[model samples]
Target: MKKLISLALALFMVLSMIPASAEAAYTQAPMLDGMDLPPVAERMPVEPMVEDADYLQIGTYGGELRRAADGGNWYNGKPIEEGLFRFTTEGVAEPNVAKDFDVNEDATVYTIYLREGMKWSDGVPFTAEDCVWFYNAVCLNKIDSKGIRNCHKDANGNPAVVEKVDDYTFTVTFGTPKYDFIEALTVDLKWHFAPKHIFEEMVQCIIDGKNDEALALGKAICGMEFADVGALGKETLYYFWNYPGIPTLNPYVLSTEEGKNNVKGQYYEYVRNPYYWKVDKAGQQLPYIDKIVGVTVSNVDQKLMLLLDGTTDFETVGMESIPTILESQTQINIYEWAGADWGATQIHFNLNVEDEHLKELFNNADFRQAMSICVDREELAGLLTDGWLGGGQAAPAPGQLGYSEAWATKWTEYDVAKAKALFEGCGLVMGADGFYDFADGTDLVLNIVSVADSGAADTYKVLEPYYRAAGIKCTFKDSDRSNIDNDLLANAVQVMLAPVTNIGDISIVLKPNSMVPGYATNVAWYGTMDETTATGDLLKLIELKKQLDVTASTEERTAIALQMLKLHEANQWTLAYVEAAPAYHAVNARIQNFLENGVWSDIYRDMGIAHCQCWFIAE
Candidate 1:
């Protein structure tokens, strides 16, 4: 096995990339105003991936791409900051920082190989030690870890163990077979590696109980740019934005200027990372653009205005901005793509509640089904997506692995009599004004909550009167996104009507938090194997997930996946789903290798941006 891997590595090094076009084989990089860089060949990985000459044109390296930061997930700058194993438009994993990988027959162990000479923006070698440091010191460490480490843990409560094979290769082994590793690694670029040389000393000091010294050194290490925000002091450096000293594998590096504030500043400037490893077919280092300027607009409206005025080059088409995008000039290309989605708009019931009647009423499936029938989805879709997208439920949105068309419209019809039947069955009666009261004639007001920013407040404006027309009096409440999350975690929430946490990847089922909530999206609704959280009808889901964890057979895994989807289907625990609209992107003609039709989801951290390293400025 070792000999085979070594031979494969040699072949990879000698591999020649042939671009579709017979163009010049090499080119000089754009001269930086005051900076000098080594030749592109000297800086790239030993085996630079030759881009598909068919999809992308071989390029000259220059020009800046301008964009705006719409305070949304992915399709933002997350791609400019690339990941190790990037996902394609179809969600297939492609090596970027990674060179290649292999799995044992049973899928219990995975050996991932890194590109030789892969370096961070700071020109430090990226090796297996970095991967080990990140896994041990940051991810698995109880005190310093921020992630739930759920994906890395097994059914028996054993975590995936990490072992370094060499400077360039490492193996991750789960107690059971974990087929979801590939999908999980590609999502959100959750590559578990970092520059050990950069963070270890100060981290060691902190571990040794030198508090003040560590704190002071921590601030220094992050440099003062991230000092005020404590970006440097973060447990993991994955998102320590603007900390120039923080080494990264992304194609671009954040500006470290003392006063550079992405939020307050007019724009945040990201420069090309000279150490970027990929090259075009013509052998030029990748990311043809010299810089990317993310215009910092305070609100979505301002961000849209920038795109409309032609100051910004690209952005996702917010459902609200469809008309504007359509009316734009011919220079801009627009395309519709489905997000890897769990569900869009969903009304969450706080299962763990203090208010007795409200809790019983919310936990009632008949009442929940009634609420689903109240809204005319055709009209709601028209309002939210302008009739461009439709057909959904509490189940996974279309195109996800186990989506069943039969379950989509099961109870989605706008039937007043049927809704009245479901509501009345839950011990509710209508008053003279057409609104329902309790069996004891107590007026019922269902308060649905949401975060103010996601336009859920606006969605509520549409749903409030709609529900009232169905003899149900419901009100809308808004809070910050963080507050809503905190409320859910603390079990203080009553009802949350917001975007159902969409799963952009199949790994979501393995993690299984959002749609089914088996493993803690927020105080599991059905319950989980973990004794701390309540267990419910969803135990089958937990069992299936565990079985999938240990089962090596693909056929068995697929069958189990289908079973899990069926469980969510029967439960209807999540009340309803809104349409999954195309992630709207307005691209300028100057941008090359931009996919007109693509799957853009945050399931892979900023899923659509995985192609960003391949995207370059044609101007």
Candidate 2:
């Protein structure tokens, strides 16, 4: 009865995201740096993803932007791919490779239009045939599927009906109204079309009744050994991004061969695509800059060191990096995007551990809630961010649509008495040494596994004392990133501190990883495709999320989202600390159109909703 009431209220407070209205009509975009195009109006597309208002300058072409990557592959995703749609500063989904789209009244039928003169970076014409090939031949293939995309499927579990209308147009029909499809288009991994020319051999094999050969062709195209093409199919086909022969739609094409690339190499390069479609107001091709240079540093520390030393042009700087960067003598502009990336530092209590006693205690709601209240969030924030952020927020940050104060404030108190009561109920007793002990006369020890990094090591230092004050012995085990990843998926680590991802979006609850057993401990293994692994509350969440995908009512969707948050709050599976904080990044002051207001994201591969095409450096 109590659960029902809270869910009812949460449904009532659902956020109605007001989308930005389109401009009345297309207007000629003005150049930012007051530079003119090279008179190539005849070569430009009929329509381009225009940002006339955002351009701060219209500068000349021919300067190389020097940036640092932690590893070799970072530049491929950052500079090489462009999604069908990109989310603008106003949180609206605007067309990118696609020109425009229309949906039927029932929302089942969507018609998409392509920019007529647009071509792949290799000078091949982009057409409706390419999109249809991507949908039917690539995405819906039998041998190895990319798995069914949740957005493209309907309530009845039917795949979208795709049809090619003409050279520059195509239609996708869902079984039901799919509102989330638009936003899904903005994500990088949601590639709607692949260049059919490069994979023609695989397509031909599929048509000629040679599927094994087709699969082999797919593997070979991705430059992999035949042994690596296990049943997973094309999931490993990331080789297409930098495959020297494959055509791309990005502003710059990778100039280096994939085999020769080295992570520890001093530098790599990307040259401009002559067939790039977007143009400036003055009729010059977009991507005013001619080249993108990625300089590889040995480790994470070197990235910061180079940035501070004024050697690198751009890199993300965290809050902990602020005091140090500010103290540096380099004249840099620090763009402090506050609450741009709103994830919390959280500790997941692994409920699937092999130890029966620990697992049983962790599964108890009271035990979980008590641990939630045991932390001093104010102190954690002070130690981590020097007091810039921390007022007790939970999984969904304040800016997200589903954020609830009730959920955020749940069990967030430095209550010693309450923690003692809750811990006592779980069969833990106060020890002679003023710490908690089990019935077996052993001190209660919490082993927190973390990636061995300077930042993570610093966090454990603060959390250890907080647990100690509550009569529980605290210990931290430093594990490398590869080990932590394996431990989380294999359900090996009993407890670990990880930053909570998928914040600021109510829609994210629909994803299988976050709310399921795969990523975090203490949650039932219910969200995976294998339904037998989960039951009860985990199953309930899965059903609610499916309903969210199909439900038409805004209030109803909000209620469902709120119910999930409430369930997570009641479960208290994670101890979340410090949310809605400022995230900082430093760009070379000479770079233009890098940071904007009201838009920030943490994921680096997509380049933080990157706009490298429009950025230019003055001479």
Candidate 3:
């Protein structure tokens, strides 16, 4: 018994000395103790998938693809002379020719690394020096450059500082700490990098009095005018290099011959770039598809017909096509998804000219509230788009960074009597001409302008009767796309239907500088608010945005966002409308990994078209 007790005590002592025999240690001992172990894989709480994880994996190979767009000049889309970046279907920004990147502590400075061997279609080597030269010549000078315009200026509007560390290393210094610094490196077509060697030689020749030689060189380098060599100093060169002016950077180069003539009802081809940097997961060269064809069609109707017949692989659809697409659902595959296209439609009012008569009629807060109340957004949505789109507020959508839905339910109801009473309380007297009169008995004529293509004309037609019953003479004017600028700039119309793009970033859409006044959108005919006050407020909000990380709590950010929303809403620039018909797309069954964020409207640079290296074919 004594021996057994001793044995048990010895075993207990041995076990205690073995350090508790844990399944695994949560932490390792210090280096001085010479104990280290690999960390166990932590099991994270499973998160619900926002979208389907398993997607169609369309293999990259031979397939003829067709796409459509409204008539516009290639120059209209060109920011630089060459393609530097291109959008992906997934909408995540990826490196084009750039192999990788390194960012500094405050994120103000960035070091970009390029692929070892890259060449332009013209056979010129694309190096980091080209990037540096381009920035120095174009972006800084803002001379028709294609570079984005964030770090180039301080909040006070000073030139952003930049330096080139080495041939392969470039550094950018911002006047302020901008978390979105990496976005600045994106390529714009107008600010596309020209062969520095070629351009410099031309400049040198011109400086040496060889005008004829310089002119020839200019045409050869990138078709630029070199008449004024004296004015083409280093500063001006830099400005032209960094201008944010183009839509995308990708492996495909724009064909100049096809771009010139109004090439309608034809296909524009984009071939794979042999020098493209990205590789597939299987180590195959990117842009697996041999070519991309952009086909020009008369309208969405024709495009939809072609899509259904399998004559075309892809085309952007309008609201009118949604019903047909749905009705013909089984025969045709539809990938109708929500995404950012233009922006939400808005009712814009001119706020600069203070007409007491107009003010007395519209300035009454209740009258504005009543105007908002009478419009049944859901009903209007059904009528305009057949209910494919709905639920966005006059304020931006909720998930947007600076968006506020606080006033979404504030006045979104159909109450015609309440609207009339609100107008009556404001002392707007109904006149014999079926219109309301001010205190001085002046007739209220509100002219509303709308783009010819958008369904605004039809929308105004529906509102005309309702507004007339409320003693308002609302005149509707439809203008072609070309005449829209003249109409808005001249303030030729009082009320206009316009889109407020980037509603998520209200500052871009709502500021006085916004195309529209009183609204965050540019379609507002009124000029932007006092630049000093609005800009100061914007700067504060921007700073607040920077301080808050992506992982910040929604409640904490909501307060600041609400304050910004209130500023824009109080100005009454944009009478926000619920989404009518959000754009939709259809994809083939064989096209795999087709994913989209809520804002994918038109094809943009971030979507993974170039990266996916896949082709869509009829199953």
Which prediction has the highest lDDT against the true structure?
Answer: 1
For model 1, what is the C-alpha lDDT against the true structure?
A: 0.65
Quality of model 3 by C-alpha lDDT: 0.47
lDDT for each candidate structure: 0.65, 0.62, 0.47
Among all windows of 10 consecutive residues in model 1, the one with the lowest summed lDDT is 224-233
- Winner on lDDT (1 vs 3): 1
Pairs of colliding residues, candidate 1: 187-604, 187-605, 188-604, 188-605, 316-584, 317-584, 342-503, 526-536
Candidate 3, 333-359: lDDT as tens digits? 455445442235567665433454664
Cα RMSDs, all models = 4.4, 8.0, 14.5
Residue 363 in model 3: lDDT: 39
TM-score rank, highest first? 1, 2, 3
| Model 3 lDDT at residue 490 | 52
Candidate 3 lDDT trough over 10 residues, lowest sum: 43-52
List candidate 1 stretches off by more than 4 Å: 1-28, 33-36, 71-77, 142-145, 205-214, 223-236, 258-264, 328-330, 352-359, 387-392, 396-400, 428-447, 469-475, 503-511, 520-536, 606-610
Task: State the displacement of the C-alpha of residue 136, model 2, in Å, after optimal TM-score superposition.
Answer: 3.1
